[model samples]
Target chain A: MISRRIGAAAAVTALLFASACGGGYDAAGSANATTKVSVTTFGCEIWNTWAISKGVYVKHRLDVELVRSGGGSAAVAAVLSGAADFGYVNGYTAINAYNTGFPIQMVSGANVNALPPAKPAQGVFVGKDSPITSPADLAGKKIAVNEINGINQIVTASWLKANGVEPESVSFVALPFAEQIPAVLSGRVDAAQLGYSLLGNNNDGVRSLADPFASSNKVYIATYVAAKSFVAKGDAAKRFHEAMTETAQQLNDPANKDESFRLLSECQKVPAETLAAQPQNAIEAAVDLAALDRMAQQMVDLKMMQKKPDLEPFVTDFARS
Target chain B: MSDHGAKRSSLAASAQAMGRGVQSLWLLAALLVVWEIAARLAGSLFVPPVSQIFVAFVDTWLSGSPSSLFLSDQFRVDVLPSLARLGLGYGAAAAIGISAGILIGVWRPAGAFFNPLIRLGMSVPVTALLPIAIVLFGITSGMNVFLIALGCLWPILINTYDGVRGLDRTVVTAARSMRLTRRRYFLQVLLPGASPAIFVGMRISIGIALVLMVISELYAATAGLGFYIVSQQRLFRFPELWAAIVLLALLGILFNAIFAVVERVLLRWHRNVRPEGAEGH
Candidate 1:
């Protein structure tokens, strides 16, 4: 009995090893012409998934890989390390990397806040019965932000300061966007800064104190960035640019909302209902360079950056064209 | 002659200790030199010099006065909470693991029931459990502690069980011939026999505990050293990121050193009775 069991186990293990070995090789003579592009994988880095699902990448003849990154920093790091061809980054990160001479450039816009009238894509969400209603009430309250010095923290601080509340009075909690809902629900934090990408139920005993862009004028939040060397002078870069711009138009089009949402759900694993309730970002191809410049200056003013980074070289102005 | 022999041996031991210390220091110095040279050669912003990391560490952690606990706001906010969670989580795991190990190791029924479950639990990757842990425990220090304790429990438990099960025949006979009560047997013979293995398990758990500490913080933490590391990396503060990593490494070393000292003190008899190089042991 023992011998038979061992024999069967050996056979199974050998088969597994053989299959794994076979999976790694491709025939040399096989005519594989697709340009393999690697992009960051985030619910917010929606373009690659949307493009691939809707055959946009196929249309452009690019084999895009959605590389998993923890956040903007990791994504930028991936691009810089040659692990990714293109990666998602925020305005502050792009500006910071540019200043640090990381050879990364804003290839195209990834996401922006909902154009002023509709509530901003992010907000400070407090419990339904929590006493912290206005931003002024946030004084001496614990608010959760995704990263300590990232956009959420800056926005929360700005919101508090704007409302005549001392920024230092509010303690910022560093929680992932997924956990923010639970943190708020469990009362671990007084409020959570819910970014646009984080999927959460609307009726989960949470209400927004204020929409970020409701008061602020700027809208651009994230950018699709890549190393300048990779995109500076190549037909690949041009194809990527056109594919992204067209995909963005299609995603943003009201007629394609259902299809876009479907692709988003399939890719991000977010339910359509939850996504429907969440504040959608204004996805566009052309980055608003002025907004990005203003944000870079804001970081400098906040002492998040030592000095205002020169944004001219970072913005690839003619990439989309 | 015996007195002279003892004194000479003591002197030799002291010299050996000093030589070992110098060897470790030399290795560390060599590593730092290599790191400095590599950073200069690469000229990449990502790979800052070791000196810069040390400077960042001192600036971030060692700037405060002694009266104010000699820890910077960043250290007080981040590292302190992380250490506290690690200590608490490991403490729980140790207490439960030792007891559970004894129970399953001694009693055949408990071992039969729980061995499979323990095997299955250990096989599951921790990343898969993150969301479940968040949902079940909520995103608080409780959740962090629970995750760390869970990940750490297995090695300690399994090692202790093996230690008890593998007790020497002569030792068991001696323990029985002494006519010891159940409590006395457990307190004296069983525990002493298992001390070395328990320590080995504990050493393994400590590493796992540190990893889980960082991972738990990544999910949702207001203030943790791991979070600070991620935050710095995201913000393009490479020197500060390296500083946080160094802090984590120091914490690991500090915890292990403490454990080693405690193990040596507790298991002195085991070492004396059966040294590692001895044939039987």
Candidate 2:
């Protein structure tokens, strides 16, 4: 009887204790600021991080708070839900959001996929000894994608379609960028959609099954976004907007190249040596109008977009920033 | 006692029941009120009022034809898959956890062998196991189920082990004296005796199962609640995101209520024998 009483009391206490606890982010070693503008972020994509560490946001009179998001979709959600002031996403996500009436306008460019056609930014890789040699071979085999319906899926699908196969013929599993290489090497996933970070970080001798850029010939896949309402906050919006533009400018400036790569190297966990050798260099901040147009048109063709989005309302005229 | 005394006693019991009801719901109600008032005061587009969330819930999930099983097309494709994965994963975890737990608890050698492995498994967070599960099972529904089941297995196993290992020496001797067969002793005495602890583990595992379900679906999901939530968030569908969250919370509450009712039915004997004023409910 006494044991039962104790057990009941313990259970009640546990429940009460749990219920009383509130969820929060215990951010470490961050600057204490008067006002903090939170932006959703991923592990990599360090332009904004570069700007922040360089005191670029502080220069623009804003203290940027990096809120780690799950992925592109989660980032947008955080922005939409008022949990974040800005979100980083791909072009399709921005276009798709605009079309769906949950409008998010671009604040800055994150990175474009398949940039500098000479080297490109992403590839579909197989194990060094895998029999898979091309897109056709990927049929009936699982391919790890960062997101199922995101840019990687669209690019991979376009490549397969161009190679005389249906996109649905290949299975796309959601694997994080970091895990894609290991997953492919283990033979659980036959191929992985690998970005520059994953490629630079890969120690194992994994070979490209298909260069997605070579197969599909695409570019400009990513961007940063904010809710339309937030963007309409006039001067408050313009302050962050200028801050964002300035940050992107510095990120794109060749003068800051070494610092940028070091920051990216630290964030992406790739060697500084590897980053320096990559011909693609750091993601240029300029949003490519032609690339964005191609992406929107392609998404429409793939049925990934509801309608051809009016690109005017969705993007900032910051291409040359 | 006189008739007035009896009437007063009945009134006191009703008041106590009412107080319990109010006490249980107090925190929830307070939170909602705070949320609604703060949202209204702030007038932010991101934090929609709780009332708006409910309205969206109906619009998003309930505004559909029976062809889609009375769920919105998105819910049919997204929410149903998530529920299926959660159910299958949790079911497998409970079965394996109970059976394995009994093995570990009832047999000293099995306990000795599994203890270190269980401790190691428990020490590793469920999210950390996702990469391994993906590598082993690929990104199929099989991988999601594997993660959820593995994530839920530990608490159930540990609780059941404690219950079975702590089985009274007198109870074992009594069963032996009665010459009960192994199966009979297990079904009639062992399981019943261990059920309370098992139920506690089960209650805890349900929460774990739901968390893993979301995390697994967040990656490599073709259609699931997490996918819907993430997609909606990406698209800036604030109301819909909130709606999905509300639905998930309701589902959790409903599942726990169902478990409570089932536990009550199964453990009616335990409740009856439990001392008066010790109605742990």
Candidate 3:
């Protein structure tokens, strides 16, 4: 009985091994040759939309694999861990990672242009009916921001400082974008700093107290980054950059604005009408090297990063071509 | 019993009790001292001191708006949603697990048919199924619950099978000789014998359920404790993230303690029934 059981178990194990080997070989031939890039779910809209809308990169003989992650920081970690060949991260995250000794290079710029300019993606919002009207009123009041070292917090802090509000004068709270509206409506917080994608024109219950992008006009929002090790010497890396640059150009074309919005809406699972109506004024697709440098400097000023890291070493000049 | 025997037995029992008390107190003191030293050394980013975490906990509990405790509203939105999902998902897992476990344990044919599938299911990590779950359920509470249930179901089922299969053969034979009805056989023999294993399964499942709960929340949740931690970590609110971790750990310890208490109470009769000098008893 024991021998028979052992034989059965062996058969099961062998079957599993055989199937896995077969699958791996099939997948390797078709998918493994292409470099896989993991973009955060929040940033998926831009990358996926650009990939499908701009047929330039697809025409360049490059196969792109996109993986959805949670946030910019997570995308960097994914690349560092070898889970992804490239990652889509925010300027703040890229600066932080570079300062912390993570060998990463920004290949192309993803959201450098903030167009509508009136309201940026990151903004501090107060309830429409709230008594607190200005940054000074936020003193001793709870203000919701997404994360401590995030671009929103840095911008908010600088704005507060510029307005003569002490950093410690007001309490900062953290909440997700979707919850920010309800949190403010429910009076859980006096104000919330939310992403432009979420707090834009549609939200009626809150008023923009400050716009981060407008406050720091030169700050780059997010970027497409790759690990230095992967891009150091490989045709795969060059192909990736070529694809990314082409996609960026396509995303910026005025003629493709409607198509771009539709693709972004579909890929992000956001409502088409809502995305169409989203304020695209401040959204840019060019890789702004100067803006990136300023963002790095801001992180240094805030002490979130050790120093202002050299952007030249970390950014591949794909636009030069 | 002889007086001399009674005296010796009492002395041994008292010594053992004293030793247990001393050991427990020592353990508690060691843990506190270690926590204080570690908290002091690690600083705010890696580890918040226990004192500050305690204050954060109190603030979260007492504040009318828990979202006010952090720099973002994400924590406020995600915490309740995550907990609600956990409750629903865990409850479903428990119900299905116990019923299936009992059924398979009591019937040889049922156990034989389901054991292989149960083993296979347990080996596959639920995280790997995230994409499939998202595709099937979308990025909603349903996806979270499905993952949690899938993670928690196996341990309970396996424990139930082991509990029933290990029952004393003599007891089953005796019950059969007496011609006890199938219902009576289960109620009086199978279930009682399997109770200990069921509790074991429950204990294991609780932890697994919590992990699954966190993972599901972290990936796509708009709100929950997992989402709160991720968002905070992303934003570099290290103190808030640390506070959330502390709270989660406390919740886990609390859940385990509650389950243990329930087990002890339910198994009180079984405790005395064990043969004297038996290793387990």
Candidate 4:
């Protein structure tokens, strides 16, 4: 009788295992599914949060969940690890992810530095009392970036090269945006790459040393990414892309300025007046393929990767112009 | 006849030791095998097989020449800086702990004053003090060292105090009757009596120091095992990240083993403890 019971138990376990493997159910395939997106508090990710607050996702009949990742690398990890269906990551982070065999593709562009006549969205800053007058002085000094070998690091390197300094001469220290200013002020780092919102309205203790992104009129700052598997499975990517594109368009329209800043104020926790005073970077829903290709080459030149991985396959149709 | 018997007994002892070693290590070997099999079957990128991890570890950390102990440039860049900070931090903790412990243990007033404070300090998590440390020390190696020292300090101090307090009353009386100088009493009587407990504290502190070292290096660090691990993880190099993690585990084991040897040598005269190579009771 005991033997019969054990046999029955084993058969039941096999049946359960078979059932677990048989389903092709995906979150994107379900109606009224919540799309979880990983994002950071600053830069391009703020838009994702703003869209949620503005009810743009709801307009597209999508339920969006924004997960606050620490940084671009973390956001990429979240997407890759299935913690989120999509992540907003720095362009270089997405490129590095692709180069290293992570099956992630760009779903949409998040932000790019504005074409000059408008100040770039990011710049390297030094303490007000620092002796570093130019990019040339930064050759041997440590510079803080949100993530070392991230987009800021690459832009800094390219900017350094433009200034006749070898990118290898300077060291990149990884610090959070919150700590970067303090690091600069205390001389822990000689300079730091400060983003738009992080620069704040009253930047008293620090001075802008150089616009690192000024070297390229169209440096892709950040991109929205989804796992290749997720993009392939259903229309969730389609809906998300349309919603984000609409949000971007609305954010860019001068008529929507008051509404955009108000939503952004809620997302960033900064006053709407303060946000209005800050120069905004261009927000594009279409992935900048030419810019990413250039960045891939730059990664190769900087020896960050063995060779530039073809970025074409990684940019999905929804992200295309 | 006696010599022949001695030889036979020695052979049996060696065989027994071999068996014990195998018995102790078999579980680890079995676990590794199981992990390898499970990982291969799963075919997940996150959990690569053990063999791949081993290869990655060697390539990432042991690809240098024989003269340098087969240590790679990456080891010098990452591991050595971490070891420096750890050594400084642990050394500071040991010095401060033993000295302060002696004072607190011997002086009733001081002990009473510090007891509650030490309890409170020990209860507070070290990671929570990270922001304060950063504010006080900036994001330099100084901050890392300060955190490590703080984390390691409590255990060593408490253990040393216990060791001092636990010393035999007879020994204290004897030292007093001999009229030894305060310095002489501390050196000859109090320290030796309290050493075993002090060693216990130091041993516990070593692990804390290592954990703090990793935690500190995770932020604003240009080079260190923690930084290397985070970078590799970000780059999606799972094997390399796993290799760094394995190296950290090995470092932990190596530190404990070194501490064990030191304790054995130092505490050899204390009969209460079991000595290595001692025959059956």
Off by over 4 Å in 1: A1-38, A41-68, A140-148, A171-179, A186-188, A195-205, A234-279, A319-321, B1-19, B24-27, B66-70, B107-109, B124-127, B181-183, B279-281
lDDT of 2 by residue, A1-321 (tens): 999999999999888776554122112112332235787777665667677788877765566778898777677778878899888777777777666666677776756544444675567889889998877888888888877677788888888888887886777777777677877776778888866546645646687765675554445555678877777653334456666667667766778778888988887777777876665523555566666777778777776665676677677654334
lDDT by residue (tens digit), candidate 3, A71-116: 7777877876777766777778877767656678876655653535
TM of chain B, each? 0.91, 0.89, 0.81, 0.93
Give the Cα error of residue B11 in candidate 4, in Å: 4.2
lDDT per residue (tens digit) for residues A135-161 in model 1: 888887788887777777776676676
The worst-scoring run of ten residues by lDDT in candidate 2 chain A lies at A22-31
For candidate 4, what is the DockQ? 0.44
Worst 10 residues of 3 chain A by lDDT: A23-32
Q: Compute the lDDT of residue B230 as modeled in candidate 1.
A: 71
Please give the TM-score that candidate 2 achieves against the real structure: 0.72
Q: What is the lDDT of residue A75 in candidate 1?
A: 86
**Which pairs clash (backbone N, Cα, C closer than 3 Å) in model 1?**
none
lDDT for position A188 in model 3: 62
| Best candidate, TM-score | 4
Off by over 4 Å in 3: A1-44, A113-122, A146-148, A169-171, A200-202, A265-276, A281-286, A319-321, B1-275, B278-281
Per-model TM-score versus the true fold: 0.80, 0.72, 0.54, 0.89
Identify the candidate with maximal DockQ.
4
